[model samples]
Target: MDTNIIIVFAIIIVAIFFFIWGKIRSDIVALSVVVMLITTGILTPAEGLSGFSNSVVIMMIALFIVGGGIFQTGLAKMISTRILKLAGNSELRLFILVMLVTGSIGGLISNTGTVAVMLPIVMSMASEAKTSARRYLMPMAFASSLGLLTLISTPPNLIINDALMSGGFESLSFFSFLPIGLITLSLGIMILWPLSKLLVSGKDREKASSSKGKSLNQLVSEYQLADNLYRVSIGENSPFIGKSLQELNITSKYNVSILEIRRVQSRKRFHKPVDMKLAGPASTFQENDLLYVFGNINDIMTFVEDNNLTLVDTQETEMGRNALSVSKAGGMEFSKIGIAEVVLMSSSKLINKRVKESNFRQLYNVNILGLRRKNDYIIQDVKDVKLHSGDLLLVQGKWKDIEKLTEETSDWVVAGQPMENAMKVPRNHKAPVAALIMVLMVVAMVLNIFPTVVCALMAAILMILLGCFRNVEAAYKSINWESTFLFAGMFSLGVAMEKTGASSYMADGIVSGLKEFGPTAVLAGIYIATSILTFFISNTATAVLFAPIAFQAAISIEANPYPFLFSVAIAASMCFASPFSTPPNALVMSSGRYRFIDYIKVGLPLQVIIGIVMIFILPVLFPF
Candidate 1:
């Protein structure tokens, strides 16, 4: 091997060690590799920086925005609701439904987003079924992983596609991996659906059930807020129809505080009717606006009659009853409204201060809906009560504001599941437009009307132009910068490996080791290697590291590289065996009260099954 290749190999070894060590972040480790390659004279500055301008990076950013548009429009949540309706009370039926819906949707949107959207639904379903979330959450996490079978499903797919394109092969089409994806998804559902009962232990179920002992409704009853939450709609002739919250001063006039507003937008084709908006001082009350108000039952009833408003009996409508859940308040528009349980830290500045005196609402734009101190519940007049260390406050506000509150860790420690600000709102009015853009993008790619990168860019821009996303800032925020940087750095590292001949050196060893058993064994070896690497590092990083080696191995054997490349892609996504392997798995770990062994028990078998399926499928499909 050349001196440069030896140096590059040493750098990579150090990088891999750091990745597994979990001290520095993967992105930083990747960036350090790029900087070391540049400093070592292995790659020119232009070559090292080329990844920032790579088409794959641009496609990733565009896809993030497009996925955000789909999420922002509440399309995923709508699908979940419809599927849940069909699932009923059977745990088995619910598990299958969750896997099917989340997997299918994960193909189109970010799998992480799909998991975030489906989590609460699964939790609620598990609760309603009188079962533990553990019975359902592991399957849900695996389904999100299965979603990567689609070409547009996850970042690893894009990375592998870009690798193939860079190697001078025709880029894989959007549906190229459909056959394997479908088979894998079906297999996952089959294994996880029935095995959930055994894989998820009874002890775990008992622990989860005991922890979440009180349902949301039960808590509401405990707080005596059942009658305080009233759903009323503004009548066509109501005087408040054209007025803003500040203008009407409903809090003063009717002695009721407006908590949320659900308004139906003008009817559009293929769009759902209602759009939920958080109520604020500047928000206008329109005709037919559904107001969720908090006040004495008698006062609210008298105000409804006096103001020509219709009181909506929540008991009569499922939507009404759903609105009663504090966690479900921010289901519409991702960040519009959210509820969080925050615990005051021991050294919190607000520990002894009254909520009103601290100007909590003014400072954070969040309402102290309720508070819990030890065994005591303080629901009414929370603003006047003094906060204590270890006091848990149930706060409601814009998700962004709540996020800000949580970040002030010196003052508060957020309890329970970490608030995911990516909740979808009912922006179904924009769904048709968003769907049209995505369809066109897919068509353009499938037919080679444009490069995949260009098609993705056009779709992303259309999402903004069509109002699927509210603004450029929204689009910008939607992009996961960590992922973008990580991929960019990894791309450079891949280039360094190739330029320094490190990839060829590694490929020769892998090819020579398995050549006696022929190409099928070689392919299986590559897949297993990639899968093991993914268990420690990110699937994206694993794909990047292995893609070049796979291509080099095929070159050494004088056979087609497609099968080897496909194996790397498939294997990278088989990161189901570890809780830390994927974001979705980690997200569900605490809520499901799952231990690391739980993932190993469930994911290891699924990983082996997928490997067996891939070994048989790849050679036939790619003709290696």
Candidate 2:
């Protein structure tokens, strides 16, 4: 081996060790590797910094903003609410619906964003449906990984696409991988759905009791005499349309409590729980009025028929309909809303800032909905609460703003919340215009109408200007620069390997060892090797390391590179059986309250199932 190649390999080994050690942040480690590679003459200064300007890196940043935009707009929550309404009928069907919705959206949005938005809603739905959230969360994570079908679906696909373009091929088309993606996604779902119960344990019994032993449904279900919530959307010809709750004899004749009255518009205005008393005297029912009433299930059924009210089987109130209509009218997913915990990081400048003084809502579009400090708690009126260091702010906002806070404001870490916020849909007239701009930007990129980075960034900026995002500060905060740095550093490493002919040399050695078994065997070898590497290294790093090698292996065997690339691509994320495998798995491992063995027990079969699906499906779709 050449001396330079030896040095380059040593740097890579050191970098890998640093990443696995998990003491320093991964971005800092990656940046140090890039600097070291440049200093050692392993790569040129331009080569070391080239990844910062790479379309793949830039696109990842913009895509994150797009995901953030969706959250800011309240679209994700709308989907969850709709799912919950339909889910009242069956848990199995609800699980399938959640997976399909998450998978489809994950393909178009950030999987992390999808998971973050859906996690609480699904947990809530699980509570309402009397089932364990464990049955659904893993599927959400897995389905998010199913974003492999489209060029714009995930960062990994974009990285691979960018690499292929760099290697002298046109970019992969938007739906190029759908045939295989859909198959793998479907098969993975089929195997996991039936086995998830047997493989993964339910919620921790002691912990569940501590939090609240009663499921939402159980809390409501026992009200055999009263206390069930009936959410009905008033229809045009409905007899209840002109009457107040008192006139309708809802509370007088039946054991019932009206929880809220919501007006659906270009935005949704929710009548507070305290406002329920006004429902009987002050309110006149209007078309599409979403009335949430609590009563005995039997009384609610009778009330609905007697008053001729149509129970809104949909989870959404008329308010959500307006949000969805705006989104669809503009051609996109509805804007999303959520509750998030933003922990004050040691380095955050806002460590001691009060919510009012911080202007979080006006500046970033985030509302400090509540505060948590150890056992201390404060409700939505946080504007009056004094801020303190180490406090975790329970915030509500468009998904993008929360994302920006977690990424850019070194002051906050995102912790999941299993609670709902008061539904207040703010009107953003720019919804349609913002959607059009984003869709156009995407279409332009697919057609090669503009540089991907410029197109996406421009659309993102326009979103900020139009109030699709609250502001540019939030947009800037949404970029995960750590992953961006990792991409740049790893790209430099790949370039060094390619320039040194190290990749070709390594490919030759691998091919010689596996040549006896042909290209199929060689592809399988690459997949398994990448899978092992991913267990130790991060998925993006593993992909960066093996993608070039996979291409070279294909050349050596005189076979199409697509199958080999596809194999490594799938294997890169199929790192189950270990906690250190992927961040998503790590997230659930901790939050799901599972031991290390829990991952091995549940994940091992899923891993085997993934391998089978990929190996069987890849050859048929891409053909060696």
Candidate 3:
């Protein structure tokens, strides 16, 4: 091997090791590979960075925004729920419906988005049926991959399509994956139906707890905050007028929680008369601003007296009126103000910082109303408590503001499904517009009216313009920057492999080794190889590494590369043996309370059988 080829293989080996080790993130590993290849001079700066500008990557970003709009407007849930109602309390029907519906939607948008929209609904249905979510969720996740009907449905599809076009092969049509999707879904339904029963079959030692975290009211009652809510006002000459909430140190000094600030905007000619603002560290106090505070009356009184603030009366809160209620002013509306929970991940930067030092209100525009350390609630000195991994904080903020916490996934995970509460998705009325836009986008792609990326980008822009999301900010937040950057960065590694003859070298090794066994055997080797590789690494990465080699192998054999490329796409996608291999699989692990053994018994069998079937199926569908 040439020096460059050896260098490329070394980078690939280390990158794959990191990807499988799970110590570092796959995206970080991919970007590191790109850096090494560029720094080694194996690739030009333009070649190393070209993947960021790939059309496939752009399409992925647009599709994420479009998927976000669909979920934000509750459009996916609305359609799925009504269709699911037809199942009507039958577990078998629910299982079949979930597979078909999630797959169909997964074909149009993203598998992750499709699973997210359906997760709550599935859990709800399973609850009503008096069962664990174990049986439903894993299969539903598998079905999401099985539903890859469009070019943009999954990254592997998009990667394979890009490979074909770059290799001078005719591009696949929008619906090229339709029959493949149907076959896979149908096969999945048959195999998974019996295998998935094992998820719920035995006397499960694990309880039915989804471990999704506590509900809003549960947090209130557990912390004994039902009667602790108080609404107070900023009186004239209030010393707090000019200072931001961060400067006050009220939570630490007074031990009182200011949940939100309700402002009465003086009558304006065109704008709404009443406005509400969620209190954050940076939120400045204004004259006559009402503070929704949560604490004992004595502590509240001391703060009120010290700041020259007056206690306003409460109407009715979710906690209900109690002795602490002042009974003078209209209460803050829960429509805008809401409660959610966040648990710190092991790697959170705020782990060792005191609550005051962390500045929850200033940094995240939310207050840490309560913290759960193991089974105890830290109430008295919340501000002084140093944080730890797995510290569950009950956060209060405007629903829009709380949504921002989700963007920091590595630091903390939003506990439970608080955003799924009907009251939070205020844009539900825009479901029709969202649905129409999705329909038109799919139709345009099928008709070949524009390039696939153009059609997706147009839908994304329309979803934002027509009020399908909370705002442009929400639309932008919907895109997963990690996945986008990972794909973009890793594509350059593939380029380096091809440019350095490493891909052709591997292609020749496989071809010469197996060519005597004929194309069918070589195709089987390729499919089996891709499937095994995807078991430990991401399917997209597996597809990226193998696509070029598959294309080269077929060409060296004087055969069309379409079948070989299709095998790479299908094998890369359909891996189900391990949760770490795909996003959708890992998504259901906690929700289903599944052990690794459960995956082996359930997912591994399906994975092996699927590979076997596709080996024969791919050549028949797209002849070499």
After superposition, the stretches of candidate 1 with alpha carbons farther than 4 Å from their true spots are 83-226, 231-265, 269-294, 301-312, 315-433, 469-474, 508-624
lDDT of 3 by residue, 228-332 (tens): 778888987998898998799887788887877767664442232346677676789888777888887899999999999987655643233542221121243
Candidate order by lDDT, highest to lowest?
3, 1, 2
RMSD after Cα superposition, model 1:
8.4
Candidate 3 RMSD to the correct structure: 11.3
**The CA-based lDDT of model 1 is what?**
0.71
Poorly placed runs, candidate 3 (over 4 Å)? 87-93, 105-182, 192-333, 337-426, 529-607, 617-624
Model 1 TM-score, 2 decimals: 0.59
Residues 407-472, model 1: lDDT tens digits: 788888866543333333334567667668766876675455787678878888998888776567
Tell me each candidate's TM-score: 0.59, 0.51, 0.56
- Per-residue lDDT of candidate 2, residues 286-381 (tens digit): 876777665457777777776657777544434344433433211111235444566777777775666768767556665564577787665424
* For model 2, the run of ten residues with the poorest summed lDDT: 269-278
- Which whole-number lDDT from 0 to 100 does residue 441 have in model 1? 72
Error of 2 at 100 (Å): 2.6
Per-residue lDDT value at 260 in model 3: 74
